[model samples]
Target: MEHSDEWTFADCFHAQKELYRAIISAAVSIRWMIEHDFEVPTDADLRQMEAEVNRELCDAWVEIYVLALREWLDGQ
Candidate 1:
């Protein structure tokens, strides 16, 4: 599958369900961390965490997807 900025949720769902699941799991893990690790986290802290999580997850997904694609291609 070709990578494109125009890819939709259905495309990703069909192409890589595991990656989608991992993204959700990571987001939930971060939510749990905030709830347990913070006594009184400020709004700014929450926002920062949210942004960082999103950035990290997106980067991770792209990297993993590319690597998976490379392996698939190599086997072909």
Candidate 2:
């Protein structure tokens, strides 16, 4: 006797769901930045502000790249 299983479909579905979520979240952050361009800090605050900007830019870029990759993967 043999037992049958159906896990591949489930696995692919989960992966697609996560990919969609990541893409949406990345897009949202980019929009948020564009919509709200407030001032940064000065003096000591300037250093901290610069650091924060760099971090946010890096994160946003990573997300954009990931979403692009996912789109490419879906195509292939």
Candidate 3:
């Protein structure tokens, strides 16, 4: 399959969807931690959570891109 750097509308839309999902999931996880933990999260803990969410967002974007590429190839 030929690879193109261009992105389609559907690709952007799906990426946005995945990003929103990741954000929501991160928010829920943070809330859970805040509610269940005996002490407030330390600065290091917050930093770790931030890093994890960033990784999750990056993974989601990559997954969306791969899926879009596969669909484009199938349509070819």
Candidate order, TM-score descending: 3, 2, 1
Query: Is 1 or 2 the stronger prediction by lDDT?
Result: 1
lDDT of 3 by residue, 2-50 (tens): 9877767586658666666777577857775878684677888777777
- Alpha-carbon RMSD, each predicted model: 7.2, 11.7, 6.6
Per-model lDDT: 0.63, 0.54, 0.69
What is residue 25's positional error in candidate 2, in angstroms? Answer: 0.5
Show pairs that collide, candidate 2.
none
Better of 1 and 3 by TM-score: 3
For candidate 2, write residues 24-74 as lDDT tens digits: 556544554565564343466545445555565555655656655565566
Q: What TM-score would each prediction reach against the true structure? A: 0.38, 0.40, 0.43
Compared with the true structure, the alpha-carbon lDDT of candidate 1 equals 0.63
Residue range with the least summed lDDT across 10 consecutive positions in model 1? 6-15
Candidate 2 deviation (Cα RMSD): 11.7
Report the number of the highest-lDDT candidate. Answer: 3
Model 1: CA > 4 A from native: 1-37, 63-76
